[model samples]
Every structure is written in structure tokens, then in C-alpha cells.
Target chain A: MDNSVKLYLPTDAAHIQTLKPNTVVQIYGTLYTARDQAHKRIAQALKNGESLPFDLHTAAIYYCGPTPAPRGKAIGSCGPTTSGRMDAYTPLLIEHGLRVMIGKGVRNAQTVESIRSHGAVYLTAIGGAAALYQSRVTACELIAYPDLGCEAVCKLTVENFPAVVSVV
Target chain B: MKIVDSNKIRSDVAKLITECLITPDRAVTNALRRIDTDSELEAAAAALIVENNDIAERERAYCCQDTGQAVFFVKLGDGVQCVGLRDALDDAVRQAYAAARKSVADPLTRLNTRDNTPAVIETELVSGDTLEITYLAKGAGSENMSKLYMLTPADGVDGIVRSVVDAVERGGRNACPPLVVGVGIGGVTETACTLSKRALLRPVGVLNERADVAQLEKLLLAKINALGIGVAALGGRVTALAVNIEVAPTHIGMLPVAVNLQCHSLRHGTVKY
Candidate 1:
């Protein structure tokens, strides 16, 4: 439990593999936010032979749906959603070069195997720590799927975002 | 007779929702404080959860982003008269959600209601003139894992225990670990399910009145924790914080058991007027 690992987004597969399970890490740089609906859309697009909304290389996806920001705050109370819901679309994203995912809950066996095989790692954030996590978000902007409301895809700039490597 | 005003009730209800969201219940917070973790991973995770609650309170933010569906349990007094009770509660929910800027969407269409409304209201007419309302903002993660089973009489208490453990095992990380399991035994299918949910309204760590029922709760909790589900479904010593059981008389031939899993956030509160 060193708890000192600092990872930059778009990290390489080799780097991800070196991280052990339960290793606490502070992630820096850009992290894309997507939940069940956005994942479905991406999976469907790939099925139809279309490009994804953002390049997956070295990208990290966070399963979250934040409340509306009151006024001057960078974001509202933001925390991880259940990752199990995204188990169906995860392997596909990993195969397409997804290197990191931040969420809570257990992943299905297939998703775990995909993470290990595809050089991806799944990280768990403290599930209910919405305010603490939101405090780390420096900025947030809607990236895609505006119609999904809180479930929309957004790019979040975070500093020292806390998470534990669950599977690598 | 207590003549309650609709407007007053609406405002009070709205404020109650906000209060419950911003502040974690004392009983739940105390339970988290008492969690003794076996592994460093669990310890770190537990620390973060405790810190999160403090931050949420100081910053007036939600403990979890998924503010959850609005569920209300109301006990109306016979001598209390408030016109348009349902509409007032609905209006309160709408206003509260808008004020908090939380999301509530249509289940099928995924369309945001803009304001959370049409709260699930369960009402009971009691004896006194005081109106008691309990609010539970149930997150979808745990709510999705809730189950109901209609067992034959032969299943007995052992059967009930096995089914409860099975539900927790299958729920695993999906429902969030270190959970509060609400068990409802007896009654028919729907009654069993409602009883299970109502069971959750009880304060965490409190036991049933009947000695046998209390013993059953202890047994179920110990067995569930033995599964080693831990916090956030990672490996640890504690899987469930408490198991609260509520039973209702039912047909002799049927044994209906419903298990409702609640996450660590346990956002619920009560206000009496």
C-alpha cells in the first residue's frame, strides 16, 4: 500500500501491467466520463463500422454521472457509478485501446480477462465520495451526447484524482 | 384536530429531501466509523468514504452523484387534515430536486424530468394527529440488485437464510459491499417485497423485537460477512454492516422472502409534524 503512484492519462499497456492490484494511485490529466448510455452508443457505433467520439489510445474512462454545478464550481458532486453495468461494452472498448477505467463495483470475468489481456487496468474510486472527488475536478466540459442529460459524455480535467488499481 | 397546511408541508418536505442528501445519517456514519478493515486496501477505501461524508456536509454536496429515486413512507394521523397531500409531496420533490439540481429520468426513455417528481409514496393512516414522513433516496446500483422469492412451506428458516446469502453473493460488487441487508419474510409476493423495503427504514444496527427474529438477523449477518465480499467488492472482512428483518403474517402454505440491498451511502431521514 505505497499509495504514491501518479499516473498520467494515455499511459502505455506496459506501464499498466506493472501496476499491482490494490495499489493506490493519483491520476492526473484528462479523463473522459461515460456511463451506461454512452457506452452503448460507442459499442453500437463500432458495430456499425463507425469511428468513436474520441480516440481510445491511452485514454481513461470514468463511469460517472454528476449533478449540475450550482454556480462557480467546476463540477457538481461527482463520483463513480457501478462498473458492472458497463461490463457488456468494456471488453470492446479495451480492445480498441482503452488503457484505464475508474469506477466502483466488481467486473464480470470476461471484462477482467479482457483487462489483463489487452493491457488495460480497472481502478475503483471510493464509491460514495462524491464531494471529495468533485473537489479534485479542475474543469469539465460536455464532449458528446448532450441529450443524455447527466449521463452525457464529458471531458474532465482532474488533479490527484484518487483510485485503486483493482485489475491490471 | 391538527390542521396542517399544504404549503407548509410542501416546504417542509422539500427541505427534508435536501437535508437527507447533504448529510449522512448519524447511525450510518457511526457504523462506518466502527468498520475495522482487515486489509490496507479496505482501510484506505474506508477512510476515503468517511472523508467523503465530511466533505459533502461542509460543501453542501451530495454524498454520491446519483442522488437516487425519491421514495417516501408517510404515516398520516387520523385527526390531521392536509388537503391535497399527494400533490404537495410531489410538488416538494419537484422543487427539492430542482433546487439541488439532481437528475431523475424516465426509466424507459432516459429523458430527464428536469425536476424529480411523481415520488413513490407509501401512506398509512395511524391513530395520532402527528404526520410522520420517512424519506429514502435509494441509489440505482443497489436497487437494481433487489430480489423476491416465493418459497414453499418446507423451505423453513434454513431456506430463507440460504436465499438471503445467495442474493448477497450474486449481488457481489454490483450492489456495493458493506451493505445493509433488509430481509422480509412471510406475506405474499408484493407484500413481501414492500415489507423488505420497509425493513430498511429501521435504524441501522437496531434489531427486531421478537427474540427469534433478532437471532435470525444475527445469523444471516454473520454468514453474509463470512462470504468475504468486503468493501466495494474487493477482498475484506466485512460484507454487510447490518441485517434488519421485518415479518408479516401470511398464508401457511407460502413463504415469501424478499432481500433488499442498500449501499454504504444509506441516505434516509425522518421528519414528524
Candidate 2:
């Protein structure tokens, strides 16, 4: 097997620039989970000029809604959900220093342009490979919006999480 | 007369839900392993899919987090008497999604039903004494991309092909590439949608019994793959794993076609009792 391109998270401009589309990569380190409901809340928070959940500059957003973890497991089936659904809120996040976005499926033209102009990269976690991914996460804990249930914002520490660069 | 207890139905459906959500379908896994792709990304994609199947099976973990809403298609036997069918399924869904996450929601209110209750159940009466249940934990990603088309009868076979292909194109990467495209041709709007979804219950790569319909399936599959959607829409030759088409006679003036797309995960199963 070819060695996967290593990408440690809290990614920098230099690191993000080197990555090319379609290249297989394995990410390691910290990220935040935000999906539909959470995105709306984030937008609302921004509008209100309130404190944001996590520092967008240093934290990547994963469009996911993981299952409740079983005993002795950090998480359960932590797969990526459709990224397209987040198109409306992504460009704003990109503008706020978000460098990396990870999820499955396609992004809209608007979202793609924003990623390009802002020098942000979008990665695709294999949609069906959730079990493999859950194993990669060493720790997971609630970050915000716990009432949203699985859609709540959470922090994850992953190691060797596999993905492919989809947009840059 | 055959007596099928509702309690047995509840428990059996619960087991089926857990199994279908956690275990990769045998035919789909086989197809993924059998992928012959020259693209490096395609090769990588296939490897991940194969590895995921093994992990899910070994750990008895969900293949994807979405777990989705429980959608059941049932064939009820004429002589088999079972009351409270919906109640039994509701119990089963509540039991199955209890530990996992609850995805079903009140659309207008956006509050989850909590236990993923009130599964979408469709039952048909058949001639035999056995009750056969097919379950699909229909997730949001691909489900969101699915479409319904009302074409004019003049659209005919070519129109059907065009409609199905168009849906895939629009779905693009959003529906999850390496898709299982289910085409429901004919019927009214509702039946067309149901048939399209039911087509997904067929084993991966299986053809319809009708020769012409089977031929259409082959042709449509080729066209979808040719779109170069690839796995995860990353870009490659294999966009779809299979295209299964189901058809019914419709009114002469209208051609109701619905396209249901299933991601590569393809979590589904059949239980007969």
C-alpha cells in the first residue's frame, strides 16, 4: 500500500497549499463537528456578535452526526454526512479562518468558489466507512449545542483519519 | 390460517434493523471487492469500502452514523393474520434506535420523535402464508438528493432513460457517487416513488425479470458510470455500482418516474417468517 499523505490538523496555510485534489490523505489532531442545526446556530451567533463555539482559525469543521458511542469506544460510526447541505453557511466559516472542511459528496458552485478564493480545502471522508473512522478518533466530547442530540457540536481528537482532497 | 404474532414481528424487525444498519449487504460488499478500477483514487476508494465492511462486521458497529429513518416494505400473506402491524413496527424502531441515535423527526417542528418512532411502513398482500419484510435505514445524504419526475407519455423509454440520468447528474456527488440508482417508471406519483425505492431492495447488480426492463437497467447503469461521478464524486469511471429499474403500467397521458439513489453503504435486508 502506498503511504498516505500525512496531514496533521489545525492546518496551516503552507500545509493546505501543498495538498492537491484526489490525493489520499490521513489527518491527525483536533476538529469540531457541525451539521445542519449547528450551522444555523453558528450563523445566528455570528449575527448576534456573540462568542463563537471554537476558534475557527485553528479548528476544522466536520459535517457529521455520529451515533452514541458504545462502552469503551471513543465514538460510534463517525462518518461524514453530505457536505452540500452546508453550502449556505460554509463560505462564511471559510471567511472566518476555517482552512479545512471535511465531509462527503459535492459542494455547490458558490461554496467551491469561496473555498478557492479563501485558500481553504475540502476533503471527503469515505461516506460508508464510518466504523473505520470511529476507530481513528481517540477522544470525543461535547463542545456545544448538546440539546441538538447527535447534531450537537463536539470536539474530536482523531489519529490517521483517512480522506481524499475533493476541493481546493 | 396462519397466526403471526405481533410480538415476534416487533422483535424480528428490531433484529433486522440492527443487522441491516451494522452489516454491509453481502452482494454490495462483493461488488465493492470486485471493483476493477485503473484510477488510483478509485482503487483507494475501493480499499476503504472493503476495509469498512470488515470493521463493521467484526465490531458489529454501524456502517455509517446517519442510521437514517426506518423504512420497511412488507409483503403480507393472505392467510397470515397479524393485527397492530404499525404498532409492532413502531415498537421495533423504538427498540432499535434506542441506543443508537434517533433520526426521525416532525418535519414542520424539527423536533425528533425521540425513538425514531413511526417508521415508514408499506405493506402489500400476497398469496402465500408468509410475511416477508425488507428494511432500509434510509439516510439523509442520498435520500435528500432523490427526485421525482412527471414526464409525458410521449417521453417513452428514451424519456425514462433521460429522466433517470438527469436525476443522477443533478444528484452528482451529493447523492454519494458509486450509487445504486433505482428507477421507478410508470404508476402514479406515489407508487412511482415507492417502486423506485423498492428497486433498491433487489440484490446489487441483479436485473429485472422482464428482458426489456433488464436491458434498460444495463444501459442506464452504463450511462451513469460514464458520467464520471466516481466514488464519493471524486472523479473516476465508476460513478454507480448498479442501476436497478422497476416499472408498472401507468395512464396513457402521463409517465410518472421517480429516481431513488442509494449510497455505496447500501444498508438493507429481507426477513421472511
Candidate 3:
């Protein structure tokens, strides 16, 4: 069953709509990494009408806080954190045009509603497949909230990043 | 009295954490292999785990990003004395996090201490002269979904089963399935929680020595799989790989039941001295 759908970064609404829950999705291109602290900061910035470091429209954020990259590696072992932790901030982000999230776990009711209404997708990365996930990332760099260390927002370039469409 | 060098313990713990992060216990891998992969999701998920293990082992990389909070359960021997055992554990965790990921942080600040130090060390005195240390890289996903219930003696066996099944149902795929369900029964409130976590260290599919507890484990396992949550809740017959219940004597009036979960990739090991 290698009929996995391929999704390139900067994907449009039409591509996301084609994704149903449980569909295997392999992603290519840029995906941002953010977890609890970074999400909190992003939410606060949005609430204050402060321009975010990255635009929310067409943005796909992975709920992750990865370890530091070792020598000769693009990034450290990176996998999805529990998506539910970001549930409170998610509806707001979705309202602002955040189209996709990658993480483990189910979302809260409000977050699920937001995901449904916004035509966004919540994808499931195999929770403990850190080494495998890391191999998919070709490049990584810290972009915001460096002080948060691993919790800092990062920009990652990946290819064939496998995930299952979890919530829609 | 047997005097041990603290440095040896520090280095040993460091190695133990490093090994556990990449290579899960043999029972965990075996359980993962045995998952009936009838659903494509379960099969695919299982493949990812196997590939992840391959990558981790071949490249010396972490199998999961959330290397988890370093929790060490120590069984100290009466005849053996070590002055810096605690410090050695703390130092070992710091060394391990340096190579992998630093998951420990202040709860209030939610900021990384940079060095993942100050491991949670639980110690009990045992009869032997060898110090035994059990390590569990407790991930946040499953941990966040843990439940603790305070039921009266009236709740009985039914209550205990409900508490476990309910927690697994509530957690669903978020707690990460196919899961190893750890049910802690009959302890003071907090002890139940600890016992539940301790239950996870047991080898997969192994029954408790107590026959009744073993039966409860089997019953709970059947009920859990019947939930049809499956792997990643993708829908199938195997939601839980096993159910392990750890029990202790508690107050006559109150019955405390706590359910803790470990994701399919249960990272744990034991080092004895």
C-alpha cells in the first residue's frame, strides 16, 4: 500500500482537502518546528497584533522540541510532541490560516472544530521514530525564541517525511 | 561494608541511559514485532519503529526526540555504602543528555536547565549487597495522560478495571498505542501512581506472581484491545500490547487506583552492582 500522497511545502487548500484522516502523507519542503513555549509566544504575539516571525497563512507547524544537531548531522533526533498540549493555542492559529500540524496524540474539541472549519489537517508522526524522522530532515536552523533552547522555533527542510492524516 | 567508587556508577548510568535511548529493552522490540499488523496503519507504524531502531543503532542516534525525564528506581543493599550515589545519577543524566536530548526542565518555567540533571531517584532498601538501578526514560506524551482515581472499598475489582479502561479510552492514540497499560492498584494515592510506573518495567506479556492480579491483567488487556483504538488508533484488534498491574497493601477504607501508560516503544533497562 505505497499509495501515500505526496505533499510539497507551500501546499494550497485543494491539496489539504484531499487528505482524509488515516491517509498516509509524505511531506517535502519547509516545515516549522514549535512546541508549548514557542506556541505560547506565537499566540501572544498574534493577540497583540505583533507581526509573527513567519506568516501563518499557508504555514505548517510541527509540534516538536528537538535536541541539538550532532556533528555531521542536519538535526538531532526530532519527532512529534503531544499535539494536545498546543490545543488551547491552535484554534487561534488556525483562524490565522495555519493549515497543518504534525504531532502525536488527538486534539481537544475546540482544536478539532477549528481544524474542521479551517480545512486544516493534523498529521500523526510515529511518536518514537526519532532517528527515522531526523533522517528525513535535510537541513535545520533556529529561527525564533532561541532562548527556549530545544523549545525554540526552527526551520526544517525535509523530504518524504511520513505521517498519517490524523484529524481533519 | 562494600565501598563502591561513585565515578563508576556515574559512568555506568551514563552508558545505561545512552543505550536505553537508542536500543529499547529486548521485550519491547519483541512485542513490537509481534503486533498483528492486519491494518495497514499498524503495519506501517511498525515498520517505522523498526526502521527507527535500525537508524538509531547504526548511527548511534536517539530513537525518540523526547528522550524523557530520567527516572531511576534504586534498590540499595544494606551492606553496601556509597556516599555520592545521588550525585552520580545526577551527573550521569547530565552526561547522557549532552549526547542525546535534555528533557528535564523546571515545571514552572518550562525552560531547559540546558543540562538534564537532578534525576528523580526513588530508593528502597533490599536484602542483597548489590545496588540495583532501574531506569525508565519516561516520555511526556503517555505521562501527560496518566490518571489517578480515589475509590472507596465499595469500588472493588470493578472499579479498578474501570479506572484502567477509562484512562486508556480517554487517552486513546494521544497516549500513543499500541500501548503497554500499567495499572497500579491498592496503595496510598501517590504510591499507586509510582506502582503503576513500576509495572511498566516488567517484561512484556509476563504475568504478575499473584494469580488474581494476573487474571485481572488478562481481562484488562482483552477489554483494552476491544476498544479498537488500534495502533495510532488507526482502528484494529490490538490497541494494547499488554496490561501489567502492580499491587500493594493500602488503607482499609480507601482504594487508590492509578493508571500509567508507556508507549509501544518502552525505553527502560536495569544495571546492577
- What DockQ, between 0 and 1, does each candidate earn? 0.72, 0.79, 0.76
**Model 2 misplacement above 4 A:** none
lDDT of 1 by residue, B92-186 (tens): 89888885544667779877777777788998899989998889998888988889988989999989999999999998577766788999998
Residue B92 shift from truth in candidate 1, angstroms: 1.1
True contacts kept of each: 0.82, 0.87, 0.81
Candidate 2 chain A TM-score vs. reference chain A: 0.97
TM-score of each: 0.96, 0.97, 0.97
Question: For residues A1-168, what per-residue lDDT tens digits would candidate 2 score against the true structure?
Answer: 259898898888887989988888989899899999999989888778888989989889999999999999988888898888899998888887788999988888999999989889999988878898988999999979988998999999998899988888
Sorted on DockQ, best first, the list reads 2, 3, 1
What are the interface RMSDs of all the models?
Answer: 1.8, 1.3, 1.5
Name the weakest run of 10 consecutive residues (lDDT summed) in model 2 chain B: B24-33
- Name the lDDT value of residue B23 in candidate 3: 83
What lDDT is reached at residue A32 by model 3?
95
Q: Which ranges of candidate 3 are over 4 A from the true structure?
A: none
For residue B108, give model 1's deviation from the true position in Å: 2.8
Reference-based lDDT, residue B267, model 1 = 81
Q: Per-residue lDDT tens digits of candidate 3, residues A39-112? A: 99999999999989788896789988887798999999998888998998999999888998899878889999
Q: What is the overall TM-score of model 1 with all chains considered together?
A: 0.96
